[model samples]
Target: MTRSESVRRAGIENKPSSAEMDNIYYTAQQLDTKLLSASIIGWE
Candidate 1:
């Protein structure tokens, strides 16, 4: 959780769009469909 919006405050806001988020949340682990897919794995 170290890397979040807070950490990205220094750099660019690297996050998927609202529609993309819906797809990611809906789809399985089949990410990377987009050129810059925002696929994240949560162990916790």
Candidate 2:
């Protein structure tokens, strides 16, 4: 699934651009944490 989709699934109404979302996913992968949903959702 795309990062946008994943973020949406996490219940974030406002979202960043596709590029920004991709960067977040990439950074999360680098950190090896399951904070993808938490981090993005928390930004809301």
Candidate 3:
């Protein structure tokens, strides 16, 4: 029941590193409008 045995059973070849799992992603905002048209028009 060593770390190598646990990793082999998971079947991903290797588990994801902590940095990869905890990484942050950024999304861009587009086309701001009034009267709630932004979401309705799929601008965001």
Give TM per candidate.
Answer: 0.34, 0.41, 0.27
State the lDDT of candidate 2 residue by residue for 1-44, as single tens digits. Answer: 99878888999886578999999989879776556656876842
Question: By summed lDDT, which 10 consecutive residues of candidate 2 come out lowest?
Answer: 35-44
**Count of clashing residue pairs in every prediction:** 0, 0, 0
Q: Model 1, which residues run further than 4 Å from truth?
A: 1-10, 29-44
Assess each prediction's global lDDT (C-alpha) against the native: 0.63, 0.78, 0.56
Candidate 3 residue 30 C-alpha distance from true site, Å? 60
**Backbone clashes counted, model 1:** 0
- Candidate 1 TM-score over all chains jointly: 0.34
Candidate numbers sorted by lDDT from highest down: 2, 1, 3
Error of 3 at 44 (Å): 73
List per-candidate RMSD values in Å: 11.3, 13.2, 9.9
Best by lDDT: 2
Candidate 2: residue 33 lDDT (0-100): 54
Compared with the true structure, model 3 gives a TM-score of 0.27
* TM-score, cand. 2: 0.41
Q: Please tell me which predicted candidate would have the highest TM-score against the true structure.
A: 2
For residues 1-44, could you state the per-residue lDDT of candidate 3 as single tens digits? Answer: 98878889887586557775554211112223342586787766
